[model samples]
Target: MRVPVQKQERYIAIRNVTILSVVANSLLTIVKITFGIIGNSHALIADGIHSFSSLAVDAMVLLAAKYSILPPDTRHPYGHGRYETLVTLAAGLLLIVMAIGLFSEAYEQLVGHKSPSEPTSIVLIIAFAAIIIKEAIYHYTVYIANQVNSPMLVANAWHHRSDALSSSIVVISVLGYMAGYLWVDAVATIIIASMIAYVGFEECLPAINKLIDTSINKDKRIKIKEIAESVNGVFFMHKLRTRKMGINILVDMHIVVAPRISISEAYKIAETVRHNLLDEMEEVVDVLVHIKPENTMNSLDLPQRNEITSRLQEQSIEVVEKIEKITLHYVDGKLLLDIDLPLNIIQNNNQARFISQQFADFAVNDPDIYAINTYYHGTVYDSPKVFQIDELHDFIQDKN
Candidate 1:
């Protein structure tokens, strides 16, 4: 099957930007590492390691963007968005490990009192150049990340930012060394490592939260509630749930409607709420709404149509054979029923009212039933439609 236009566009954007980052980081890594060794600048060498880490993260982003756009399948009903999140987490762990290793080496150099060789002007030029290039890549990557709304791309962009920051530290360390300060270079390396570790931890936190299906923030929750309640026929909403899958949000909620509405009406109300939320909230990709009657608690243990019919049969309700429909309504812990029947059983309005009273008297002993409304239906002579006796009575009373 062909890919959707939106996903296709997002993938193309991410792929192009990540490839750009990969190429830029590769060139910077080679230049920084080679020149740092030639000029004997340990801080510049640490900066090169940071660049190499960026290259790894870029590769992961490229892979994630490609696979994350695939449509959902049976094995993965929610699609492959989590693939990007997992890759982001891996990138963070990788950066943290690299930071620890660099920190330990720098600490050893400091403890041993090894005098760092003074860096030539070329090392300074390379450090400055790396800073400029990495900063540029950061801006470009972050821009694409926002346009695509990809969390993985955002993490990768920040990785590029951390590289630029480390290079800045390298520049400072080299300048201080040239000014005759021996300890600043090693201390600067340690500082760069600390920064790398901090950024790594920051990147890991959001990914971990997403992986565990953490709920969205309070403001978003409140907004969602407001939108759901705004829809007509929704009495109220509760049990709202939200979770992040990559950049999209998944929502599940319960809504209350009229107790006596038809199943199709309730379903239509639910679909309306779903469409409203999806239209109003851009990040929400899926919504599951459970519809419940307003009198759910009162109706939970109430007898269904089968049991109610059996109970009415036990009462020997003779008119039951003529009944067309029996609708049960629950309100305030009591059942209200509407029973429809043909007009042939009753000769006049008085008999119609008596039959209604008869049904009520039978249920008067049962505390579960609050009331019974009887509708006598007759076919109009001039029309092919049936009219209820109760409606005709109300119309006559209005004419008087």
Candidate 2:
């Protein structure tokens, strides 16, 4: 299937931002690693490793954006959006692993009582430049992510910001080391690792929630309900359900309408509600509307057609055999039936009147049935005409 133009534009924006991330991180990784070895600063080396990890995250973001935009298929009917979420989870896990490694190395250096070499002024210059460059990349990538509404891209932006933060901590430790505070470098490494671990956990949480089909926020739910109720012909709504699939939302709701309205009108009302929601909420991708009658009990609780037919048979009415269709309407807290019968049942006026009288007498004491209308279809009737029990009641009263 052809992808929509809007989605195509969004994917393009994501691709551009991710490419920018990859280029920036690649340069920073090489610069940090090259200067760290020359200046003998393990902190700079660790920071460079962090930058390299960010490059991996950028690659994941690019791969995810590529597949996540694929149009839905039979094998995956809900589309490939969740692939982005999985990529985000992978990025988070990578950060966590990197953090653990950094912490262990820092702890070993602290325990081994190794004297750290003081970095030259050139390393300080490199660290300052890295902070500036990575911070700029973070801001730019985040702006693009917001424009395209890509969660994975947002996660990657944070990765860039985290690298910038680590570089900032490295600068502080280097300054302290130059001032003869040798323990400062290892402590700073541990601190930066802790921060990275925190951000990783933060990224993992939203992705995990999406994977489990978590609902949107309460405020969004209220707004969606208001929008649905604003549509014309909707008497009320209930059984509303919502869940997140990556950045998109899915909604399922039951819309109540008047029982007497035609099915087509009810369907039109449902369509209107769906359209209004899609217009108002940009993140919503799909809405399922179930039509129901207002002010009625659950249909399952009411008597079934077979049960009603059995009751009529017990009364010797024998109308079930001639029934072409049986429509049960629940209104005003009672059941009203419209039974379509063959025209042969209405042979003459006397037979029609007697049959209507018999059904009326059967309904008079049955509290479940408020009224029953019989419709005849055949050559004689030409058109299906409804004969209500109320008309029979009027005729009997007139005779009395």
Candidate 3:
């Protein structure tokens, strides 16, 4: 869940920046359009149209930033951050389309050598002011962008830049044309159009990069791996993927460790890594760390083996390692023993067999004795009589 914090601060920051951008663009658009009509300069009018693009971009910023912080929903479990990116990309595409249209219009004028007669002084002053003011807006937006790690804000910053560049082109073209050089205006418009293309390219490329899951670079990848592997009992990571979701990053990976470790410990390590990632880089929305165990089944087998090993090790002094099994027989007072004795000592066959039979023989022959049958697993095993015959057997006493 995306718990929305810093909402007021973020809203004020975005709202003020957006208002500033809109005011600047609107002012520039009105001023340029008025001067273009009075001065009879279509290139200046075209520049006004280019500046108009900022209105939509600013609107996008306001709308995008508002929705970006909305809490996660069932439909959007990842929150609405990507909506901001999509809007920014749309704004960039809109700019590119408008620039292309301007290029086509400028191309006709270029071929005709159409001279633009304009009253230069007012337009030049306003254009210069637009440049300074827009650049200021750009810097301010960039500051906010860095502060919040917001891609939408960054896009808005460059939108201000595009406006400044468009205004500069208008100033150059109008000033040069006022000096009676006709060709400079069209050339300037074309140059600004190319810059528009560059801006479009820059904005679109990152969106594509994000969509493609571009590596978060090799240095960071190695660092993340090192962090995960450094935790005690964690072997390594697999499928360590990192990609941007808006300005924030989405990381998913498998964190491998010994299987015997408890879930709480695994969660602790994963939590540590997640916190470190978030602390070190604020632009991470979600990190999914999958806990993987080394060998799952071997963990179950070791306990049973360890339990029997412990029992025998406690019983005898000379024994190094032994395997033993106990079975109660149908016959009354009897226990069967299956034993495998290790070869640390040089003992004769009889001695080895007797050693294997040691527990059953001792237990059975006692007055409380059950009849005992023993199997010598390490040596040859033999079937033995169930119990010894006593003198009473000759009497053939009937028994039910």
Per-candidate local distance difference test: 0.81, 0.80, 0.67
Question: C-alpha displacement of 394 in model 3, angstroms?
Answer: 43
lDDT of 1 at 87: 85
lDDT of 2 by residue, 1-400 (tens): 2233498788889888888888888888998999999988877887898899888888888888888888788997778889899988888887788778868877887999776667788789989999998889889888998888777877788788788878886787778777888778778878888988888898899899999988889999999999999998898788899987767888999999999888899999999999898878888888999998986774556677788877887787766566777788887677888777765555455666677677778777787888877765544334344444344444334433
RMSD of 3: 14.1
Per lDDT, the best of the predicted structures is 1
lDDT of 2 at 182: 71
> Between prediction 1 and prediction 3, which has the larger TM-score?
1
* Candidate 2 regions with alpha-carbon error over 4 angstroms: 1-5, 105-114, 301-303, 306-325, 330-334, 340-353, 363-370, 375-400
For candidate 1, lDDT tens digit of each residue in 291-386?
989975756777788888887877766788788989998877788888988755665666667777789997798778888888766556322344
Q: Lowest-lDDT window of 10 residues in candidate 3?
A: 391-400
Candidate that beats the other on TM-score, 1 or 2, i.e. the better one: 1
Q: How far in Å is the alpha carbon of 47 misplaced in model 2?
A: 2.1
* Model 1's TM-score against the true structure: 0.88
